[model samples]
Target: MEEVKFGQDINKQKHKKMNQTVLITGASTGIGLEMAKQLAAKKFNLILVARSAEKLQEIQKHLQDQEGVTVKIFAKDLSNSANAISLYNDVKRENSKVDMLINNAGVGLYGNFTETSLDAELDMIELNISSLVALTKLFAQDMLILKSGKIMNVASLLAFLPFPYYSVYSATKAFVLAFSETLAAELEGTGVTVTTLCPGPIDTPFNTDSMLTTNAYKANKPMPASVVAESGVDLLLDGKGKKLVGFNNWFISNLPRFTPDFIMMKIKKNLASQRK
Candidate 1:
């Protein structure tokens, strides 16, 4: 696929439908929150989802007051297996049409399989994989009926490789990356687009707590979560399929394919050492 250039002209070129609704999961913080702010700035009506109702309400007020966009908050734990379809049903019950779907709700678990609890891994799989897929099915069908919409899934650089410690996290992201590319093709000519935002080590609250970044090594360049969110939105709106966040990340993420497994392994080992 061709590399999509990110800029402002692309954003202004697309016109927003009056009161078009955008549903964003995990919108209470980090990249999801920034995406909500950017979309609200463009005057898209928003339905924000996350576990924290209080935080969501606060963000809703700020975005509505500042950007003058219609905003709604759904305080639900996306990690729950049943909540995915329930969230979709709630949106339908509220009579909101989903014009854009952002599958940004996810979690990460670091350490050996034995070191991570079964419950945590189950939760990660349900949220990062199952819930994401469930929500996509529901919202994509909605978009298919409308014959116009966009879906952006937040994947990670690890989607391209098998990380030593972050095995489950990488696996979940791989699913997202592959699913987004294939779905984009399937939805072609339907006036709907699906994009996977494969950001590398974003400086978000999520990464701050992860050993994947702390122990493994330094990022060649770490972008702010807001930058990733804004650029991702721009790419998806421009009908781009996949996006690499920072320039160095783009290079490093692709380098493993050409570099020997031994060298990549050493690099990953060094990076993992930083966790402690």
Candidate 2:
């Protein structure tokens, strides 16, 4: 009996080592880049996808030299509606198993809806909402078939509010939060787990590129990208359904769910005033 138990333990360890590959979208920069670094450090085989082949090659080189992890790059524009499913098909062609999926490819338009170009806003919707939903469904079906997998969707603190300037971004994140929560419930019996990470003000390229840091209020309350990445990954691995990155963030994220709308609006108004 002891011999049989020891053999089972060894088999489990071997299986864990062999199936540590993760596919992360938008991995050329920002949170996705940081996540790739973290996962590689843990000896996971990585498949990094982004629009820029040059940048993806740079990250691949760094990971290969630094961590010696198997790193593959897929350069594709995820904003294209069919690209998400195309990505899945490409990965399967490589004969690689996706043990985890990180749907982090998203863009934000930082102006009033009317002020922002219709085309750009539509692209934002394609990247942030449509692609995420598609990838989650595509890869998750594979995971379901294998009877094991994990998913982490990067949401935002804006998910808790209907903010003025970042209207579309907030709405997309709200959809992510609700969608991930419901998916987690449905997949409970399946060996698959989903975690939506609602991080508050991450300090990364996302801030500068998305015009988030330009906001005086957000720029002042920035948290390191590594901190958010680590916390988010840990929570997802631990099977935590939903996690807001910081302690204060968790409080504030839940606050809107309980606080009266009129009171919340009053607080938002006061906060907006201080920023100006």
Clashing pairs in 2: none
> Which residue ranges in model 1 land beyond 4 Å of their true spot?
1-15, 208-217
Clashes of each: 9, 0
What TM-score would each prediction reach against the true structure? 0.90, 0.89
Task: Indicate the residue-level lDDT of 122 in model 2.
Answer: 80
For model 2, the stretches where C-alpha displacement exceeds 4 angstroms are 1-15, 209-220, 269-274
lDDT score of residue 41 within candidate 1: 84
lDDT of 2 at 48: 96
CA-lDDT, candidates in order = 0.84, 0.82
Q: What is candidate 2's lDDT per residue for 110-222, written digit by digit as tens?
A: 66578888887788888898999999998999999999999999888888765666778889889998999999999998999999888877676665444543443563487
Under the 3 Å rule for N, CA and C atoms, how many clashes does model 1 have? 9
Tell how far residue 220 is off in model 2, in angstroms: 5.6
